[model samples]
Target chain A: MPYISTKTNIVITKEKETTIKEKLGKAIELIPGKSEHWLMLSFEDNASMYFQGKSDSGIAFVEVKLFGSASSSAYDKLTAAITDILKEELELAPDKVYVKYEEVSNWGYNGNNF
Target chain B: MPYISTKTNIVITKEKETTIKEKLGKAIELIPGKSEHWLMLSFEDNASMYFQGKSDSGIAFVEVKLFGSASSSAYDKLTAAITDILKEELELAPDKVYVKYEEVSNWGYNGNNF
Candidate 1:
């Protein structure tokens, strides 16, 4: 499973949210063994987030959690794709986006650990 | 910084959200060198989450990311405390909650990396 959780200072509309999910689904698919079916995503807009002590700046924090390991190069690709998606869809600067990854040992699904 | 992002299938009210933030702030302070000032929390309810093949169950996904490493026992303490908070605030079963921890090396804040 791959879950992409994004928190941003920008405000999101219903249309933007739909487009974001679609774009994120495509971005996740760039990694082998990841697909939209197992992808879970949540976007938080107008979040109380501060970057360099300023909360009004346009910033995005993205956490990507996957079931297993990925190469740094693979992560780099995913990061670029996500950054592009946000920049294109939300008018956010690529430099303002932060992407974090986690290779999880055990992920719970269906009341059981996977 | 400590960011606790909670995604659950339960519907949340405004009052419950306030109580959750307060309780989570306390939970963060339970760990040494952590406090409410660096705590950033988000609660996502009625989310699209699936466990073990079913999406209708009462399940919660909690992702906790901290700037540095912590003892497994420390993580255990956090998992228990957060579970308890969700249980009391949202009447969710402890077993239904899944807590994930990540020790991040590079965290960005206020337009700078920490």
Candidate 2:
């Protein structure tokens, strides 16, 4: 399973949310064996966040968690795609966005480990 | 640095948000060398989350990211404490909450990698 969550200081209109979701759905394919069918997404708009000890500018933190690991090259590609998606949809500067990936060894769903 | 983010389907009030942030600040101490001074927290309430193909119940997904590594036992303790906090504050069942940890090797801050 692959999950992507975005937290931004800028307000995300419902329309922008749908567009970002769709873009991320396609972006997840950058990693082999990952697709939107099993993708879980969350968007937190107007989030209280700071960068460089300030929160005046627009900022977005996108987290991508996968059940297994991917190559560094794959991660690089995904990061570029994610940055582009946020920049295009939210107008966030590429430098103002942070993308993090975690390969989870233990994930629980429905009262059990996955 | 340590970052703890909580995403749930329940609506978190301003009062409850303060309480959860306080509790999480204390909970981060379960990992040695981590404290609230360098902690960053984000709460995504009323999130569209589903578990086991259902979204009818109160479900929480908590993610803890550390700049470095921590022991598995430390993670276990932190998980228990987080579950307790969410259950006590939000009345979510422990089984319905998932706490995941990630040890990050590269973290960015202030337009630079940390």
lDDT (tens digit, per residue) of candidate 1 on B13-32: 99999989998898887667
In model 1, pairs of residues that clash are A51-B110, A51-B111, A52-B109, A52-B110, A52-B111, A53-B110, A109-B51, A109-B52, A110-B51, A110-B52
Candidate 2, residues B40-92, lDDT tens digits: the string is 99998898665443457897888888998987678878888888888889899
- Candidates, DockQ: 0.13, 0.20
lDDT, candidate 1, A1-114, per-residue tens: 777778898897867777778888778877888887777666678888888887766899999989778888889999999999888889988878899998985454433445
Candidate 2: residue B47 Cα off by (Å): 2.9
lDDT of 2 by residue, A9-88 (tens): 99989778777778888888999998876666777889899999999999999888887699999999999999999989
Q: Which residue runs of candidate 1 sit more than 4 Å off their true CA positions?
A: B1-5, B13-60, B64-114
Docking class of 2: incorrect
Lowest lDDT 10-mer window, candidate 2 chain A? A105-114
Query: Model-by-model lDDT, in order?
Result: 0.79, 0.84
Q: Candidate 2 — which pairs collide?
A: none
At residue A33, what lDDT does model 1 achieve?
82
The CA lDDT at A74 in model 1 is 85
Best by lDDT: 2
